[model samples]
Target: MSSPTSSRAVPPSSPPSTQAQPAGLWPGLGLSAVAALIALGINHAVPTASALLVAIVMGVILTNVRPLPASTAPGLAVAGKRLLRIGIVLLGLQLSLGDILGLGWGMIGVVIAVVVGGLLVTEFVGRLLGVRPAQRSLIGAGFSICGAAAVAGVEGVIEDKHEEDVVTALALVVLFGTLMIPLVPLASTALGMDPRDSGLWAGLSIHEVAQVVAAAGIIGPSALKVGVIVKLARVLMLAPVMVWFGLQLRRRGGQVEGKRPPLVPLFVAGFLAAALLRTTGWLPASVLDPIKMLQTFLLAAAMFALGTGVTASRLKNVGGRPVVLAAVTTLAVAGIAWSGVMFIG
Candidate 1:
């Protein structure tokens, strides 16, 4: 969590009141918006495809095929981090405490177990396989919670010095999440699972909300409804999990006080507030509908920004360790979630 020191020297006579220039945000935001539009078009053309997935794919292709300008780095960083947090905040509007509790204690317990156990198992497997600790933790969190967003949340706290880890974890999330879209429905049907159970399984185990929705949607509307609620229940665990990681990082020392993510991030608090607002019936249907639309667009943009940070070179340099870790973690989560669903039934 250390703040990066600037190599540039300031003159002793320079005014203390002077501030550094702010990074530009337009380039990144513009690209992200373009990606989102492309994703939207893809989603429209192929109903089963997820906009978020398309956005990320477009980002990766653009970044690798034609490198972005150096000037766009600052804005892309903003799009990746700031926009991501905002999207996560907006994600809260989709959930309510009542909706979660209505799933009953059994389903709630399953979610808790999957999140907690998946995180621990993934981290352990990553470490055992010799992946870097920070990267391992990011992978674990990504699988256990909300995919790239969860990994970004953990990185904000631990402030991993390497950007490669973030990209690697996100790449894996996109890959496995995409794969789950078809596999979950096929497996659920073969197993003769009730649509509700299939939906819950998809929601609890899939890496991203969009992926969860895609998987559940193929199962049916009932499964889609069940999936979203269960997914949000897992999302609710993010704040506490992040706080725990932050505290652990601080205890390890070398953490800069102001640079570290807060124990309860403002965005997480905002998410809770949004959920409460939904529960209160104060937000009219007119307002709620637009906000939901905004949430998808924002997340799609953030995901595109995240994808732009990745490169084929970086992935090659890391070798196959990350892929192996991703595979292990994916299996672990899927197994745990499937077992939980059957046990609950």
Candidate 2:
């Protein structure tokens, strides 16, 4: 009996992560700068256009390589997206909770009105369009509630929706939201809205915080505070609505064996944890800035991934139902947001 001789040859090259050096700081910063620059160019209505625009540019680069089918992509991208939502929520820390609470509470009635009204109106249109009820419900969650976060949360708990429907719902939220960034201010001025009222309306109505900032910035600084507070209040609604929609999706046969995941508010809890960390002075101001910067970096990376993910053909086929749902729902929400600000303030 003899020991077997070794046959394998060692490779000389470093592994991919090491060989590439993890994309480097400059590449990431360059990506962020490009996003910010593009957003700045398109930011007639808003501040964070950089996120989406940057993502699109990256997406163009990504698609050129012929991506793994989204089904085959690693689970981390999905998780990365959730982390971005948490980052957005935690940005609330830059404000005094007292001020946001003070202003935001008044908008609760309006928030409720917007959330409910938008959903019902959109559902009617989705129903008429013959979209599946469960799928339509997810779209309603986004428009009536918190945009992508709302859509993602409701989707987490509902197994019935086609991935296409989920993608389309998310697309409609971002697509219409980005469009509204510039146009909302123009409409606000055309309607001769008072600055405070317009800010409140823009904050309450716009889909993303970045978009709200852009919309309010177009009005003035006075509106920035009002609008950001309004949007943060709206963001808070992601939890309860996600839970309710989760139950509805289950009732509607959306629940399958091990299909439902926890709702989006769980991530909100992580957001609150970060805020509590800040308030407790557990995180120093010096550290806080970096942590926020980290979150922004993470968000930018994810946005780049999102932009890379979509194909123009896919975007074109996102369906008429969700777009119409978004418009009608926006109208319903805006009207209620106005009424709520008027009544509460």
Candidate 3:
């Protein structure tokens, strides 16, 4: 099978050494993520919504100060992605038929319809807003399903190298979305939706699961749990959607279009298989817990890979198109997510 590629490209030799000793994975990044947790207090940060905010801000700042190149083994990147997907599946442990049963059949239809509908609307908006192809791909994927990672996964197959445009775009979406985590709950309460529907809207609409859970927890734990289940239903679509898009790129001559490409990711397949296992009930909780534990490790490793690759030189002014594209597309997502929540909730 053909492999996926990254947006970041590497040089033949080394570019001028920005630092005397450039650690492959920034030496203190773990410390910094930990420090962020400590400073914010575990009550609020860590993997919660606020943690993503801290991570992205720190990541961008680190990018400007010491842009680590994410030149890791192609194998590691592939393994990292699959592990993340499995972790997502383990998230299923938190759900069962009970939550959906409580919400009733109508909520289920609403959730399903909105996710399916939103994907089409977001894609059209991205294309119309003239988001760069890669940025368009990222924004569309990020909004439609999981953010950051989803964009990275699909882009892994579609693009040949990690151009600044892609990273810059991902950073902005993550940055802006992270910053917006607080507002979602406010909007939810203001709309006067009940906790059941409120949580569904939160999970279905929020870009990241961490964001959904955080916002819902602030509103209430029941909301948090229900929202997570809603989010997973959306996550399930990543593989089929990516496969469809990947076929288009391969048809377009894809990375062979010319460039020193990175390896294509095979995790999408793993993700699909895991989902199938979940559907078939082949993996019991006995095994799922270990998988979840493994995912936690992978999430940290992938973040490390993503962090080392970040650099401010590319994120610099970067002209205006990418930023403009992200802003417009994000606003576009907000419109869709909000309207869906209102009508469906």
The whole-model lDDT of each prediction reads: 0.78, 0.60, 0.56
Q: Where is model 2 more than 4 Å wrong at Cα? A: 1-48, 64-72, 75-96, 249-265, 275-284
Model 3 stretches astray by more than 4 angstroms: 1-59, 67-129, 160-162, 256-265, 280-286
Error of 2 at 112 (Å): 2.5
Q: How do all the candidates rank in terms of TM-score, highest first?
A: 1, 2, 3
Steric collisions counted per model: 0, 6, 12
What TM-score against the true fold does each predicted structure earn? 0.89, 0.73, 0.72
Best by TM-score: 1
Q: Which runs in model 1 stand beyond 4 Å of their true positions?
A: 1-23, 254-260
What would the per-residue lDDT of candidate 3 be over residues 100-123, giving only the tens digit for each residue?
456566656665565555556556
lDDT of 2 by residue, 52-139 (tens): 4445455445554554332212222432254456555665455344555676545666766777777787778878877787678877
Q: What residue pairs are clashing in model 1?
A: none
Candidate 2: the clashing residue pairs are: 45-181, 45-214, 46-214, 47-214, 59-307, 59-308
lDDT of 1 at 310: 74
Question: Per lDDT, what order, best first?
Answer: 1, 2, 3
